[model samples]
Target: MSDVRESEGLTLLGNQGTSYPTDYDPGVLETFQNNHLDRDYMVTFRCPEFTTLCPITGQPDFATLYINYIPHIRMVESKSLKLYLFSFRNHGDFHEDVTNVIVNDLAKLMEPKYLEVRGLFYPRGGISIYPFANWAHPDFGYAELARTRMFEQLSDLDRGDGTR
Candidate 1:
C-alpha cells in the first residue's frame, strides 16, 4: 500500500508509542482520497472501547460508537481516526454532545455523501443513553437516507429489546 496515492495522508497507522491526547482535538484526524468514488457503499466502524468524561461529575463514561458513512472524495484514515476518537478520553461533555461532535467533525473532514454517529453509552443511574446523529450533503439525495436511518434507530429504541 506504500505506493498507493490513497495511503499518502496516513500518518499514525503503523507508528509506535502513540500518546493519547488529553483533550478534544479534531485536528488529529486524517483523510485519504477515496479510491472507489464511482461506487456508492456504506462503511461502518464499530468502536466498543470509547470513553469520555461526564461534564458535571467528571466521571468516566463508557460507550460503543457506531459510525457509518458513504464516501465521496475522501475517507478517514483508521489509525488517525482512532487517535482522534481517543483524544476525547479526558474531554468532558454530555453523551448527546459527544455524538454530534463526532459526526460534525467527520463531516468537516471528509465531506462524505452521508454520515452518521451513534453512541451507546452504558447504563448510569438505572438508565442508558443512546445518542444518534447524521448528516448528508444537500446536493446529493442522501438526506432521505439519513432520515430513514434516523427513523430506524428511533424505532429500534422503541422496541426496548436492546439487541443492536
Candidate 2:
C-alpha cells in the first residue's frame, strides 16, 4: 500500500510501536485523496472501544461510535482515526458535546459530501444516552437523506425491548 501514490498522506497505517494520545487533539487525524470520486457511496466505521471522561462527574464514559460518510475528495485514514479517537481518552465532555465535536472535526478534515456520527453510550445512572449528528452539502440532495436516517436511527432505538 505504501507504493501507491494515494497513500502518501498516511503516516500510521502499518507502523510499529504505535503511541496513543492522552488528550483531545484533532491534529492527529489524517486523510488521503479519495480514489472513487466518480461514485457516491457510504463508508462506515464502527469504533467499539471509544472512551472518554464525563465533564460533570469526571467518571469514565464508554461508547460505540458509528461514523458514516460520503466522501468528496478525501477519505480519512483508519490508523490515524484510531489515534485521533484515542486522543479523547482523558478529555472531558458531555455525551452530546462529544458526538457533535467528533462530527465537526471530521467534517472539517474531509469536507465530505455527507457525514454523520452516532455515539451509543453505555448506561450511566440508570440511563443510556445516544447522540447522533449529521451534515450534508447544500448543493447535494443529502440533507433530506440525513433527516431520514436520523428518524430511522431513532426508530431502531425504540424497539420496546429496552436493548438500545
Candidate 3:
C-alpha cells in the first residue's frame, strides 16, 4: 500500500510466461499516461487470483493480493506492476515473506507516504492464512490499522481473491 499511488516513473515491470518484470510494463505505462493515475488521489489494485510454486515442495500456493496506496510524485505503471507480480509465478516462499518483499520493493522504488499489501492465501489442509503487511510514518496514526482490519475482514467474504 503506497499512500501516494500516483507517480511519473510508476510503470509496470518484467516479461510474461516467465519471471521477468519487463513484459508487464509497457501496457501499464499506456494506462498510466491515458488514465493519469500519477495525478489521482487514491488507487487500489486488486489482483484477485495469483499463483506461485513452493520452493521446496514444488507445490503451488494461492492468494489474492490487494495493493492500496496514494500517489506522491509518480505512479506505478500498470504493465510493470503486472510483470512484477508475474515475476512471482515461479518464485518460492511463504505467504508472509512474499507479502513483505513486495511491500519493501515498492517502498524503495516509489517511496509512497503510505503503503499496504494484503495477501489472502487459500486453505492448505484444513486451514487458511491471510498474510498482511503495511508501512506508515510515525506521524500518521490509526488509519492504517483500521484499513488493515477492513482488509482482514475478507475472511468474512466468500467472494474473495487468491494468488499462488
Candidate 4:
C-alpha cells in the first residue's frame, strides 16, 4: 500500500478552495503513483455531467464521458479528473474531437498499458453522436484488445445497439 506521502502532489483532492479553470486546461490533471504495478487492472471513470460547447453554433453539448484504462505506474486523482473535465464546460469542440482529445491527454498523462475514452453526446438534432478512441502501449500486448474493442464498438453501432 502507498503511504500518504505518495499523494503529496495531489492538491485538488482535499483542497476546499480550488479555483476551477475557465478554459480547456490539461494542466489541472494530477496523478499519484500506482500501488499495484505488479498486477494489471482496469480503472474506469464516468463523468455524467460533462458539458462543452459546439464550436460552430456556440451551443451547449452534453455528454457522459467514459474513461477506462489499464494503469502502468501512475493513476489520475479523481478530484483532479473531475476538475479537469469541468474545465471543458466552456470549451468548444466537436464530439469526435473532444473524445479524441481526452484520450490523447490521458494517454500522455499516464502512459498506461491501455486506455480508451468514449463520449456519448446527447442528440442535438435527432442524431446522437458517440465517439470512441483508444490506444495501447506496444510492449503491453494490448494492441489486439484495443483493436477488438474498437471493432466491437463499431459493430454495436451498426446494430443500433449503442453499446458504447
**What is the lDDT of every predicted structure here?**
0.88, 0.88, 0.63, 0.88
Against the true structure, what is every candidate's RMSD?
Answer: 2.0, 2.3, 7.2, 2.4
lDDT of 4 by residue, 50-109 (tens): 999999999999988879999999898899899889999999999999999988999999
Write model 3 residue lDDT over 15-39, tens digit each, in one string. 3343354221222222233345445
Candidate 1 lDDT over residue span 14-95, tens digit each = 7687777889999889888888977999999989999999999999999988899999998998988898899989999999
Query: Which regions of candidate 3 fall more than 4 Å away from where they truly are?
Result: 1-40, 137-164
True-vs-predicted CA distance for residue 17, candidate 3, Å: 12
lDDT tens readout by residue for model 2, 65-106:
989999999899898999999998999999899999999999
Q: Name the regions of candidate 1 deviating beyond 4 angstroms.
A: 5-7, 158-164
What C-alpha lDDT, on a 0 to 100 scale, does residue 10 get in candidate 1? 68
TM-score versus the correct structure, for each prediction: 0.92, 0.92, 0.65, 0.91
lDDT ranking, best first: 4, 1, 2, 3
* Model 3 TM-score (2 dp): 0.65
